[model samples]
Target: MSIAQLTVVGGGLVGAAIAYGAARSGISVRVLDQGDAAFRASRGNFGLVWVSSKGNKMPRYARWSREAVTIWPELHKELLELTGVDTGLHQPGGFWLGFSEQDVEARADLLKRINCEVGGEIPFKMMEPSELKQFLPGLGSAVVGGSFCALDGHANPLMLLRALHAGLKEKGAETISGVDVTEIRRDPDTTQFQIIGRDGQRWKSDRLVLAAGLGNANLAPQVGLEVPITTTRGQILITERLKPFLDFPTNKVRQTREGSVQIGSTSEDVGFNDGTTTDKIEWLARRAVATFPALANARLVRAWGALRPLTADGYPVYQGSTSCPGAFVATCHSGVTLAAIHAFVLAPWMAGLTCAPPDIECFLGDRFRDPNASFSHDH
Candidate 1:
């Protein structure tokens, strides 16, 4: 059989990362980027490689994130090898601050559930405010207690996106922008995907990757896939360049590689509204300042908002349809957290080079297929 051409239906983090990995493996690939107006989370992410407290509700997701983080080093090396770009990845450790006793209790319970599901492979600890001081030398007395997870880390998301694009190009993948894909149709008798755009361009390929983020919901059904993905709004605030006081990232705040403080991420259930709000930013600033009083002096520089492409149950969805064998759908909120796995593991699977690991079936879109199943609420 002749080699097949592949078309990845989005140019954001997930699609770009997967395309880059596939290209590196010597597959011919093209990425369709829906121009700037699309909800591009790759440009708007917290940039943390987080692994703790992900899957209390979904163990498969928790495992996938852990697996993703474990492979990040090699992914970083691959990016550097191709483009000489360092993604500013740091994995020393990270924290979760709780100013109230109830906050501490909530996290304890959450972790307890997560641990019960994992059978103890994942480690976490509850730290007293005093105990936290030693590990985190920068002190803000208001933090009553907190949790620590060694698996969490940080990286420059923009740099990673740039590097992935460059590396994919170096590996001979074609990336086209300003193309609004209006339709994707599989060939009637072949394992090929015929991609059609609003601008009247036609693209034919043997495989398709549905990674259009929140837009996946709109594009998936045409190809026999259920991209039952939702959007959660998160806004990030940037502060003026500051002294490097934060060694690790917490949910509320962290210091960037460029010395700016990135504080944010309001997880509002409001659907598809990716706009920054004062109330959310104020809440984030108060929490950050409470965690590190020194940050009170930092000047606010900028703020922006993006929607997280979340599955209803808050895990990633990766599946290749039996209805359309060469068509695949991939969606996730942890784009930064799972970039490594997408590039290394998921990409190879889509290329027919590797089988889904033992737990992969649980993530397939078919699980949500039953219209009357209790889980059907997920759609």
Candidate 2:
């Protein structure tokens, strides 16, 4: 009933993971979620805990993603044991199919560069279509080559979100839904952050975190931090339950445990328009069938779009506010892949229980302050 030690401004996967982690460490936590009205990427992602071809521009992120997948099983086991919710984590590696020889060669070069930069921590193998067909028996003739990473895997993203929420409850954290937080101000005398909802209700916390997806762009400046969050609308499609064919997840398609094929997605800079089009849906279906011919016969059951939160460079922005001492901002597109590190490593630092991660400086939003710096949000 009293002021929480830490209050998270988004109860999606990223915020829930942080709140659950801090709560497990004995910190009283409160989560404010926008509920169903928000553009929920947590439920709409491709469910890949992918690590290949990531962080080619930033070595720290490459290492961070690798670290995340390495410790994912730990969080998975802990959440399942405590909440009795299965996360459906299957980590038998994954493939990145390419339609042309040029793209496949480029992928190999990027993977090798990332691996060499990160001390060979991310081991990858380049495979021709014939070799790749061994792992993916349904590989279409259009596929020329691909790359495989042992650390890449997939999970049921909705179940992961459910399990994290359940774990938050089990750890004694408060989660408030349908709360459109409109304003935030720090009381200098009390040294507490005051959060005001749209309905004039309020709550205070000693520490505050902004992980509200695209909402972070507006909220961070209120706490004396400049975080520029960009949105890319990604459309996805799902097919009716069919016999299992996809044994491994790919960049474009993956079969869930319930036998439904999740086909996705197109990244468009449409600026907050989270709507799917017939063209993209048809394109996705064609690609899915080209990768796995059996999907052509599977009827599409659903289609939708969600916005992905990204920074200038398509990496993460994990920075604390210098003006508002206890305020922090976190945003990224790789929420599913980075969930474990965000909970285990990032939360402790935000809760003041430990120091920041060694490579945290590279992810700071301050990097965008340079007027001449050019960035690519292609991750």
Strongest candidate by lDDT: 2
Top TM-score hit:
2
lDDT of each: 0.84, 0.90
- What lDDT score goes with residue 331 in model 2? 90
**1-379 per-residue lDDT for model 1 (tens digits):** 2247878988888999999878888899899988687788865698889888878767877788888998898999889987998888899878988889998999989887887798876689999988998877776888888888898899999899889989988999998898888888777777577889898999998888888898788788888787687777888899999878778888778898889999877777778788888898899899888888888899999999987787766667898888788888899887888999999889988876677766888887776777776541121
Question: What are the per-residue Cα lDDT tens digits for candidate 2 across 225-308?
Answer: 878878888889999998887798999899899999899888888897988899999999999999888778899999999988
TM-score of 1: 0.95
C-alpha positional error of residue 265 in candidate 2 after TM-score superposition, expressed in Å: 1.1
TM-score attained by model 2: 0.98
lDDT of 2 at 373: 90
Position 49, candidate 2: lDDT: 96
